[model samples]
Target chain A: MRSWLRSEDSWAVLTGLLVLLLGLLSLAGVNALGWVPKANEWTTPLKAVSPASKAFALPGGVSVLLLYTSLLGFLCLGAWRMGHSVKRFAVGFTVLFAVGYGCWVLGHYAHLATTPNKMAEKGITWGLGLTSESGYLLALTAGLLVGNFFPKAGEWLRESARTEWYIKTAIVIIGGVYGFKAAEDVKLTQTVLVRGLAAIIEAYLIYWAVVYFLARKVFGFSREWAVPLASGISICGVSAAITTGAAVRARPVVPVMVSSLVVLFSVVELILLPFAAKLFLTDEPMVAAAWMGLAVKTDGAAFSSGAITAGLLTDDPAQQQAMGLTTSTVKVFIDLFIGVWAVVLAVVWAYGVDRKPGQGVPLKDIWGRFPKFVFGYVLAFAGLLALGLWLTDPVAKKAVKEGMEQADQLRRVFFVLTFFAIGMGANLRRLWAEGLGKLALVYAISLFGFVIWFGLLVSWLFFHGVKPPTVGGN
Target chain B: MPDDKRTAEELAKQQAEPLLPAEKWLIFGSISLGLALLGVLLWLTGAM
Candidate 1:
């Protein structure tokens, strides 16, 4: 027991668990007390006001600003500790935060409300209510930023036994929201199945082929760096890359570059995709949702895009929900492939670099290296789905649903905090010393390849003669 | 002899000299400028 506690990995895990708990607690407290800002309140800063009026607003405004202040404090601390490398991390974090914040703001402006009350009333939830969902997101962002500043503090926040329980519980709750029952409702045609599989395969192939060639020939990046970058960009973005990098024992700079590129491109895609869908697509929510899911690398980006598109294209509440669910479900499916892709990349790297038959790492070792928490995530999701389906009673379903929603919200909050912590740990000097030329080339190749494959396969399978499943419609 | 040669290689690798501070700054500045330009372009195109 003492030995287990002494392990560095164990400590990190413990820290993560605690942080997850804090996030959950904060989420529950914020939700219950209504600490989140309403849509209208978000716009308050932009409103014309006299000096006298502004004075009264200042107090409330200052509270709102606390979140940003905490984030800045965390950044400063991380910079101080991490030294020269801190700059790169700061840049990456800033890009990610800016994009995420922009999306939240845009989503609010678009009036994309998922709650039943707003849906039924067909009115926007307004004001700077501290209990609003957006407010919670803001708070989570702030918490993460603060966490990033002090690694020890961040670890402590994440590692408590309570946080571990909360994280697992949250994952279970999010499962219900994913609608596992709805999974069967959508008929899987040969076409749909083929398209999905094809998209996955093509995405992988394009990523590897393009990134490999560019990294080796154009950028002169070591194969070690190229493999992880390609895996990350082509699969689930930063998370996938980080996991694979750890598994293969790639240099730290490789993962950093991959993460930075992922953040940059993710933001670009988030802003670009919605507008593109609006302009080009036929205003079919499912089609738009599918497009967003297939094109965007991350679930959050896909969901935000889907929500915005749904708001613009449809007035039907059911349709909006369906779109949101579809985008999320698709992205989660893509996320599941991260482990498989990472393992495969690990094998390739081992054999290619070491040039030994049976001398490469055993499959068991690779399996051990894989991130295990992801399974907990999957289990939680699956559990929710089963519970949602088996429990026929409306009251019970509602209760379960609410529980899941709270948990899902908590998980997202913790994830944001984790990202903030990562940003704080980043170092710019190390990145610069390594030379960005190679990294940039790898990123460009991977991104370009992914976009091409995603666009082509999605269009060919779903858009061109084939019809995909709808939520309620046959 | 092999050990000596390996040590020489290690020494050479270590002695491969890092970029000058001025050169490093120039590279960083160029990258920042490029990113800024890209951001501006994105904004102008209403992609932001």
Candidate 2:
């Protein structure tokens, strides 16, 4: 309904859909989104900015200006519709975009981001070899410094710091990225999709039950507290915890407490798991990739972990693509189906557990609880896939190359912004706050003691032998 | 009692209660689903 526009999830979907549609117009020889800016690895700052599409050449300054104006217009429209002050949002957003994208450009400095393979070409004997995704980490660090050290700036930027919205939008764009690849190699795509499906099902059914048992019996938490905590730790973190709280009709404070812990632990996972995967599971690239999706709780953290893992594990572009694709496939499937799991819990609690005389669990609740942005992700993926299969002309090829590539660049920009927003949202001081001690202890125990290792085992079961397609497959 | 203290007492008291029949069913159902899914995955991957 028209009222849905107020939801950030709907706005993310709409924004992503608009980008996809504009990109698709290139199949008709229209280059509407070609002006979007992309930063490249560079020794000098001036060389960093360029149009995303190789087909269109524009002045670097013009490219950045065009991207800035376009993003502000689109996002400001959403803010206005959502009953936010467009003026304040625009002011905050401009500062965020400038600083966040500056961090992005800084992260791409040749000395910092040039991979080992390209070290010689960049005339650098030594480089961090973190790949360009270091931008994400830099952006996060920059935002955290502001959030903790400069509280006023952080508060001012709060109006535009929509972490989940940015990440969900990026995920929709990534769906197109994979969908375009799927068009080229249907068999490999089929394999990862099926594998990802299995991984998420196993994740939900096994991980949730185990965590719930531990929280209730081992940690001595009440059913009210344990349910949301289980959902948060074993499933997709904040969204899962919030939905499960609603399903079980628990106090709102229960989910809020659980969600804060989920955020804290997810940040921990984001920092540690990628390096762990690189060290232990690099030989099994797909396993490492799927492990990130399965283990990391938040979408931003999960996807960012995947990107960082790809950078750490190998310098090969093909292997990196493979890893990113596998992680996104698994995480997206998990995000897509959490609503059904919530519905199941609702029925079980209402009908079988409490059995309150007047209370009824309606099927319509699933619709209300469903994440609408997933629809955008599915639409983008399926639409791109259908187009890829249906069109085979030179113009279509150009569209696939230039348009999709530009869309990928836009997706990366969103990802960097998401990292910054996530960091800005996380208040490190809150972890030490009173009344969170029990929740934090339960999380630390359940997550590290069992959940993470179990996730790795499940990921290996599903994705062990699978390999991403070679570079030319793209 | 303060809200936090009351809530904590309630949680602790509930924790000592025996597992409800419905909770048992939920656990059983989840494990069954997990096993079935694992079986299907093994078959699909030719690992069975």
iRMSD values, candidates in order: 15.1, 3.9
A299 in model 2: Cα distance from truth in Å?
Answer: 1.5
Highest DockQ against the true fold, candidate: 2
Note the DockQ of each predicted structure: 0.02, 0.40
Model 1: per-residue Cα lDDT over A54-132, one tens digit each: 1233443343344345444554443434332445545544544444444344334323323433433434454322122
Which regions in candidate 2 have their CA more than 4 angstroms from the true location?
A: A315-317, A362-366, B1-17
Worst 10 residues of 2 chain A by lDDT: A362-371
Q: Quick one: best TM-score, which candidate?
A: 2
TM-score of each: 0.56, 0.94
> What is the CA-based DockQ of model 1?
0.02
Q: Which digits, one per residue and each the tens of the lDDT, describe model 2 over residues A1-474? A: 778989888998988877877787887788888888889899877898888776668977888888889899999999999988899999998988898888888889998899888889988899888788788889988888888889889999999988888898888887787677677777777777878887667668888998898887777787888889999998888888878788888888887767877877887898899889878987788899999999999888999899888888877766776788888888888887788888889889898888998887754655665667878888888988887888788667767767877888888889888888878877787666555567688888888988789889888877887777667653
Model 2 pairs in collision: none
Give the C-alpha lDDT of model 1. Answer: 0.46
lDDT of 2 by residue, B1-48 (tens): 124555445554663646788998888789898889788877877642
